[model samples]
Target chain A: MVVTIIGIGLIGGSLALSLKETGLAHHIIGVDRSPDNQRQAVALGLIDEPAQDLTEAVQRADLVVVAVPMDAMLTVLPLVLDAATDRQTVIDVGSTKALLLQAVEHHPQRSRFVAVHPMAGTEYSGPSAALPGLFRDKTLVICDAPRSAPDAVARVEAVFGRLAMRLVYMDATAHDLHTAYISHISHITSFALALTVLEKEKEDEQIFALASGGFESTVRLAKSSPDMWVPIFRQNRENVLDVLDEHIHQLQHLRELLHQENYPAVYQQIQQANLIKKILK
Target chain B: MVVTIIGIGLIGGSLALSLKETGLAHHIIGVDRSPDNQRQAVALGLIDEPAQDLTEAVQRADLVVVAVPMDAMLTVLPLVLDAATDRQTVIDVGSTKALLLQAVEHHPQRSRFVAVHPMAGTEYSGPSAALPGLFRDKTLVICDAPRSAPDAVARVEAVFGRLAMRLVYMDATAHDLHTAYISHISHITSFALALTVLEKEKEDEQIFALASGGFESTVRLAKSSPDMWVPIFRQNRENVLDVLDEHIHQLQHLRELLHQENYPAVYQQIQQANLIKKILK
Candidate 1:
């Protein structure tokens, strides 16, 4: 099948590489709003050809994969749906699925669309950061899959299977809530950690020299791009806020334990926290 | 020099291996309360011999290194001072400096003590987790060097240098505050993050399989020992609380941005957070 990946950057470019490398797609074409991204994606062999002309690209495509920033997905998705043929499948790999899912809820060709969120990425961004096996051994969350045509759902699942990703089907609302706890809050914490240290600590050299593996591990997501993240935070607002409140409460509990010099209580909490080893691979 | 390390585990056992392998110490002796740790340290060749008695271990030693859980340091350090001769020096490699420093401040042999915090180690612990050159190229924070005897400080610095550590000098209070920001809070965040995800998500296998590098990096410290971490938190209570407050406040700000659908504001905050690249090596 011919797969046209729109907004080919880290996620889209990676998807393009995986589909082509796994022989899951016959031809991979790129559709990016940035002229530079289109040029770069092609230069880096992320796509067979740059689909600078979306209308022409959509005309021949059998599958349309939207891998753009969450905010931009709203604008571009409707246009793609309007132009999609009967056989053409539309899917989105946005972090926030509920907003995008709601936007296309009543669309005429909504049955052709499958909302997906592949839980994989690196701190790096742009077309040059694309890696062929990026999706391998990751989870591909398909939200509201029942809304899409059986053929379209199967097509997306098959593509993910080819890349060695495990598929989990859930509603858009459930997907958003799970991600807010497991993924979204992590990025916020990392960004806030970076800001907290930067605002208080004047000596850059000291932070660099003294940042242990623990600090690096916790704050590593601070390196992620603002363009990709801002929309995700805005789109998944309520869930993110709820999780953030819980996290702050946990920190406050730890602080109270410290203030009281309650060593036994603090140790018990850490031992409980160590239960994370069960969930962590 | 003959070096004796008490409570041989991750930090102490690793130091023994570095000393023996580098030929920095003629004979390394280990004294641990646990028979398992004692046997493992000797079997792993971390020490030349394992001493059953702490008093005997220190009396014959030229230099005694106490590497134990933070709670036990206060108890172990005083005994070392009482047992050591004028020719011998003692040092404790504990995460918290203020408490340990204060406990030894009034001792007649106070000048013989050197307070060191080596910012190193993996999440794993115990003698088997010991690795050669674990402290190499890592920062070693020496607290209140002026209070230590010149020769004692020189001997400790030379030992650290032989193991390829870069030494930095700071007072006890400053060391605790800076470490709270860089190290202690990271553990608290990781522990809470693990708890947060565990409470909300039910699929254990899915969480393990789908834990990407982002999740691994964010929750790495959850694997640390509660026995080792609890005391550090208690010792550095005020400083840890201060940093924790700032971190929670930062998360609240991000939540507000998301709540308002302030995409631009969210983007700008993350962009500023990306400045952590400047501080992280």
Candidate 2:
């Protein structure tokens, strides 16, 4: 089927490559606000061709994928849905869901728009970051799936299935809340951590020389695009604030334990955190 | 040279394997307070044999590798130094160095001990978690090298160099301080992140289902051994508390920016954090 992917950055470019590799995107059209990204997407072979305008792109495609930043997603999803035909399916792969869904809740073609979060990404961005099989064996969250027409849901599922992604379903509100805890908070922590280290590095030039895999993995998300994350924190502000409050509270708890020289309490706290092993590994 | 690894867990076991792989250890002996770990080390062929005791192991070795937890290092280093001959080098791979170095500073055989932090590790521990090339191409911090006898420093350098690791020098106090910002704080963030998700997951069972690569990488250190970290925090408590305070402050800054709907400030903070790329990559 013909598919058009907007933004043409990391997620969009990667998704385009995955669909093309699986032979699902018979002809891919790219719609990016940045002329540079459009050029890079086509030059990197992430899309079959670049569409000069979104109106023409969505009209010519059987599927339209919205991969813009979360803030832009608030406006873009409704615009894409308004232009979509009953035969065409539109979906967004943005990090936050509830706000985007709410934005298009009153749209006449709301049934044509699906909310999806691929639950995958690297710290890098842009067309050069795209790679085939980016979604292979990864979880793909389809939020508010029931709100869409059955055929639209099925068609999106078929495409993701061809890319070998595991699908999980959740409501838009639940999706936003859960991602705030599991995903959004992670970026905030990484950025804070990188700041902690960088602030220290300014004083001690040798500090970075000491960073190893442990520090690298922990601070890896700090390398993520701010353009992508700022909007997410904005859209999911309440939940992000809730998780941030708890996270700060937990750090304070450890700090108090350390100040009191309560080794046993610190040990027990880490043991409790270790339970995540069962969930992750 | 004959070498002894006092605790055959992640760092120790991996060191033993690297020593053996590099032909640096003519004979490798294991010493652990835990008989179970002793048996596991031998069964895994991490050491030539398990020593009946640390004293005995040190007496028989040309070099002693103290790979115990930070809490135990305070006691273990002095004990190993007391048993070591003038020609026998003693090195502890504890996460914190200031307290460890201070513990053995007045010992008669203090010159025989070297303070080194490999600045490397995975979340997993124990003999089974050991790998032959764990330290390859990683940074090894030699703290207070000038305090160590030239021969002691040289022998320790020879061993880590043979493991294909780069050596960086720093004072014990600086080592603890910098690690508090870079390494130790990362663990605290991960543990806190895990607890935040776990607490939220308790409220919402679907939280982990949406956890993506960013979440996994950020929380990966939550799986690190409490047996290892609690002592590091305890030993470096002051530095850790200091860094933890700064980290909490940064998070609060982001929270306030979000709370005030100051999106530009949040974006700038992340952009500043992104400067870590120069140090890390």
Candidate 3:
């Protein structure tokens, strides 16, 4: 397969590496708005060539992977699919799906595009941060599959399956809602936690000195780039807002429980929270 | 050196193992209110024998290590100090320090007791979860060391230093305050995050299926034992409330940013959050 991966950053570079390692893509073309990123992707062996011509790359490629930030996907995704022919498959590896899918819902080439979100990534980003086998044993949620062409869906499944990802099918709306609970909320909470502690650090000297691995693990997502997350929050605004209301309510309730000298209730609430262990395990 | 470890759970058991491994405790005695924990400690080679009599154990031991829950430490710390001789050094490894330190402030044998919190642990508990190197390279916060006998403080340092722990000194008030920002808030935020997601999962099927390592890391502290954490929160209520208020305020601010579509401001806030990398690293 000849593949063109737009973005040429973390997710794009990683997918390029995985496709090449699995022999799923014989030739990989790198596409990025940044010339430096394109050069880095090629120099790192993530792609066979850097494509200066977007249309030419999409026309010759058997599969086009759009792995750009969510905000950019609103415009970039439709443009990439516009260059798609019936025989050429296009897919997006963005975090949010509903808005991106809706943007190209009426396009004549809609059937050529598949919505794919491989539930994998680290806090790191860029071409240098890419690693092979990132999606192995991870879930690849193929959203709005029924809207895509049969062959396009099949190609997506085959590619992700070759990379050993477990595929989950969901409608775009439900996909956004569930991700708001799992991925989106996690990042927001981490950012808030970091801000809260940083606020305290300004007044306290030894505050961060006492931080341990447990503290670091919980706050690690704070280091995630806002360039990636701010757009996600914007695109999935309604769902993110709904979850944020509940999250803020939960924090306030826990605070009240702690404030009222209700130790047993606080204990019960923590025990209740422990139920997540069953699902997480 | 004859060392008796009270309440052989995760911290206690791990300390016992490290003391034995480092040849710091020539004869380690296990003391627990629960017979099963005593049996587990001895059976797991965490200690040489189980001490059935508290007075006898304290009288014969060269060092007495108190590793009970924070709630129990109020009563047990006074009892241990009452049994303390000038030759025997005592320490309590509770998470919170202010209330515990104040509980025995006027006691006659207060100089014999040192307040030490080895700033390390996992979510798991019990003697079986104990590992030998749990304290290696971890911080050992010594609170109210000045209130204790100079010999007692030195002995505590020597023991933890032998276990390869980095030593830090703080007063009881500052220790609780710092931990509220760095450690305690992380656990509370995690419990709240877990509660928020678990609550959402009830109304939405397949909600947790998208959870990846990122979500798991942020919610990991929810699995911490309530028996251990509830008392710490109750004791450290003031500082926890102060930090919890700021955390909630930050979340609300981020929510409003998303609601208003202020992408630039949201991005800037997260960039500020990324500043935690300096202190965390």
Candidate 4:
């Protein structure tokens, strides 16, 4: 099938590569707002070629993907839906779902839109970071599946299955809330952690030198693109805030234990956290 | 030269395996307070044999490594020091340094004791998790080397160098403080993060399925042994508390952004946090 992916950055470019590599898409077209990314995506062969126009890309495509930043997804989805035919399927690979889902909830071609978030990324972004097996063995969350037509949902599922991704289904609101806790807050913590060390310690050489496995893992996500995350945090504000509050409260609890020199309490806190082992594996 | 690892858990066992594989030591011996670990160390061949006594191991050894829990190191070091000769070298792979260094500060064999903290580990511990190259390309922190005899420092550096690990030097106090920020606080945050999610999230299946890469990375250190971390936090209480306070402050700042729904402020906080990009790479 012909697949057209918008944005043509990390997610969009990688998705195009994965689909073509898995033989799920016969032809891949890229639509990016940045002329530079559009040129780079084509130069890198991430797509067959950059689309001449969005409307033209939508009109000829069997599948259209909205992979723009979370903030831009709302603005782009409606316009894409306006150009889509009944047979054409539109999907968004945005990190936040509720906002984008709401933006297209009442569109006449709402059935054409399938909201999917593949929980896959790296510290790097852009066409340079795109890889052929980026989504393999990762969880792909499909939100508000019922809202989309059966054919569209089935087609997306079949495509993701061929890419060897495990699929989970949830509503848009639940997806946003869960991701805020599980995904969005991590980026914020990592960025803040990097900043904290950067600000408190004047030794930049020390951080680079002494960053052990723990610090490297904790601060790895801080290297992500701010342009991508700023809109994600904006789109999922309430849920992100709730999770952030809980996270801060947890830190405060530990802080109090340290202040009191309560070794036993602190040990218990760590033991309790150790339960994440079951979930992670 | 003969090398003896005093505790055959994560750090010690991995070190033994790497030393053996690289032919860094002619004979490798194991010593552990836990009988199970001793037996496992022998079974896994992490060492040539299990030592019934640390002093017995030290007397025959050219290099003796005390890789016990941080708190135990203070009590154990003096006993090991009493048995070591000027020709023999001692090193402790403890997370905190100030206490370990202070405990042996005035020992007659102070020159024999090298305060080394290898900044590498995993959530799981035990001989089974030991790998041949666990320390390859990892950082090893050596503290208060000037107090150590030139030969002792040279011996420790040679071993770490042979393992292809990067060596960094810092004072005992600075090592503890920097570790509290880079390593210890990450564990506390990770543990607290796990506890917070567990308290709020009840469905085991949902948590298992929905816990994304971000949550896993943020909470990974929670699975570290409480026995190991409790002592590190206690030994480095002041530094741990200091970093914990700063981490809480950063969290609160983000919370305020959320509470105000001040999108611009929240965006700015995240953007500021994103500056960690420069330091990490």
Distance from true position, residue A138, model 3, in Å? 1.2
Off by over 4 Å in 2: none
Model 4 DockQ reads: 0.69
Q: Which pairs of residues collide in model 3?
A: none
Off by over 4 Å in 3: none
Candidate 1 residue B237 C-alpha distance from true site, Å: 1.1
lDDT for each residue of candidate 4 in B79-188, tens digit (9 for 90 to 100)? 99999998789999889888778888889999999999888888888888887788998899999899999989999999899999999999988888888778887887
Report every candidate's CA lDDT.
0.86, 0.88, 0.91, 0.84
Query: Per-residue CA lDDT of candidate 3, range A133-224, in tens?
Result: 88899999999899999999999998899899999999999999999999899999999999999888888768766888889989999999
lDDT of 2: 0.88
Instruction: Say which candidate scores most in TM-score.
Output: 2
Separate DockQ for every predicted complex: 0.65, 0.85, 0.85, 0.69
TM per model?
A: 0.93, 0.98, 0.97, 0.97
Worst ten in a row by lDDT for model 2 chain B: B202-211
Cα RMSD, model 3 = 1.5
Which tens-of-lDDT digit does each residue in B182-266 have in candidate 2? 7999999999988878877776776777777888999999999998888888888888888999999999998899999999999
On DockQ, who's better, 3 or 4? Answer: 3
Per lDDT, the best of the predicted structures is 3
lDDT of 1 by residue, A1-281 (tens): 89999988889999888888878788888988888988898889888888677777886898899888998999899888988877899998898888898898899999999998898998889999898888888898888888999999998888788889989888888778778877888898899989888877775445455788788889989999988887787788888888888887787787788778888888888888888887776
Cα deviation at A105, candidate 4, in Å, is: 1.6
- lDDT, candidate 3, equals 0.91
| Model 1 DockQ class | medium
